[model samples]
Target: MAHIPIEAVPYLESAIYLPMLLIVLEKDYELIEHGQFKLKRPYVHLIEEAKKLAQRDLQDVKAYLKSHYLKVVQGERDELFTEYHFHYKQILEVRRYSNIRLRNRVEELLNLYLNKASQAHSAIQ
Candidate 1:
């Protein structure tokens, strides 16, 4: 796997992405619990689903960040990002009713990183 730069992740909060992330993570956990991880087709399909969801959620987050940062923070010159330290908080609390799947996290991160890198590269171009 290619390395992702630390700063590229943005100092964003987890709650922004946590709920959607949990969905993907839960699905992955189910697959593991059922012992279906050996099937390449199922594995691939789960990864695809996770990637699609992550992409959609990330887009929402990007839009929210743009609007919120501009309207509330930049326009008003608020220091919330500094005082509250938004990055450290759990953006969304995982309801433990469902188990978390490790594979889902890997796939989600992979897709998120790749998409971000592509966006950054295109922006530079």
Candidate 2:
């Protein structure tokens, strides 16, 4: 097993899961829009802002990966664990993450990004 660079771990993980987060946010936005909520504007705005932030962060992550000549490739996956190949220069490190862990990490990231967006919105007011 090749050693994975510590600095690249977060970027690699984000590159894998941020797209999943965006899809989840999009669906949640649609659901909130159509759901029976008297005050939907706040919810909608938060999701919109969070989505924008996530997208921007994802682009930055991609740029970082490109500049560092790093790549993550999805490998075999099962219900419990998903496999990924992290390539940096001549090193190819294989990692397996549990599905539950991935879900939890994304949820945590969503809350974090949402809070950041909320703070930004509050600051503007």
**Deviation from native of the Cα of residue 91 in model 1, angstroms:** 18
Q: After superposition, how far is residue 48 of candidate 2 from its true place, in Å?
A: 0.6
The residue-by-residue lDDT of candidate 1 on 41-89, one tens digit each, is: 6454455555555666666666655544411111111223211123212
RMSD of 2: 1.5
Worst lDDT 10-window in candidate 2: 1-10
**lDDT for each residue of candidate 2 in 14-94, tens digit (9 for 90 to 100):** 999999899999999999999999999999999999999999999999999999989999999998999999999999988
lDDT of each: 0.45, 0.93
- CA lDDT, candidate 1, residue 23: 63
Per-residue lDDT value at 104 in model 1: 51
Structure candidate 1, residue pairs in collision? 14-91, 15-91, 15-92
Q: Report clash pairs, candidate 2.
A: none
Tell me how far the alpha carbon of residue 107 in candidate 2 is from the true structure, in angstroms, after superposition.
0.8
TM-score of each: 0.32, 0.92
Prediction 2 global C-alpha lDDT: 0.93
User: In model 1, what lDDT does residue 77 have?
Assistant: 19
